[model samples]
Target: MGGGPDKEHVLITLFDPEPKDITGELRRRFPHFEVTYVQVSPSRKDAEKAGNEISDDLWKSATILITLFTLPAKPELVPK
Candidate 1:
């Protein structure tokens, strides 16, 4: 909702094989919000295959992590 990661940071990973440009869509949908897409997979298949291989840096910066794929996330991987 704000201009930088300090106020709002969202990590989104889509699970659709042919994913839409969600970042672009979110920006369009919420033009007032300074939405940033961090480490989002290029495609649903890529996200699904990546599993919980998410990096520590990504988790550290993300205030909220939303995964479109139905994989079970490791508790340690979740942001506190």
Candidate 2:
């Protein structure tokens, strides 16, 4: 799929493979936006490590990041 300015790149990291109906809700709310999912380990350390390991480009392009873990907003992930 081609992504343009109008496209919404949502990045969601969750411990469970199954989305708790959030995917449906997002799709329903923003029908035009493209949603993406990233599964991370339930362990806090593992999840944080995984998130930190993501390439800068990917993080920069994401429109919104939703994490199920307790990690605070990462400055690196959120572009200034």
Candidate 3:
């Protein structure tokens, strides 16, 4: 979506897939703006690598990064 000079676009990256309730909350909180969810394949060995590549592409495309955080995994940190 295009933004005016006074407005700005924001992108938030969450390591974990957001729960349905949380997504609904976001929709309720920001009704005027657009919201989209991108589901990356966690089952693939290169999922993280692919995500990093895509993030880099987005950054190159002039998308602003507001925040980035990874979710905690189990003690073993097993891949899906």
* lDDT of all predictions: 0.54, 0.69, 0.43
Ranking by TM-score: 2, 1, 3
Please give, for residues 21-76, the per-residue lDDT of candidate 2 as tens digits. 98988888988776777777889768668777666766766777777772334775
TM-score of each: 0.45, 0.65, 0.39
Highest-lDDT candidate:
2
Instruction: Mark the regions of model 3 whose C-alpha exceeds 4 Å error after superposition.
Output: 5-10, 39-48, 51-66, 69-80
User: Which stretches of model 1 miss by more than 4 angstroms?
Assistant: 1-6, 17-21, 28-49, 70-73
lDDT of 3 by residue, 14-41 (tens): 4457566876786678665334444444
Query: In model 3, what are the clashing residue pairs, if there are any?
Result: none
Judging by lDDT, tell me the better candidate of 2 and 3: 2
Candidate 3 residue 48 C-alpha distance from true site, Å: 7.9
Please identify which of the two predictions, 1 or 2, would achieve the higher TM-score against the true structure.
Answer: 2
What is the alpha-carbon lDDT of model 2 when measured against the actual structure?
Answer: 0.69
Better of 2 and 3 by TM-score: 2
TM for candidate 3 is 0.39
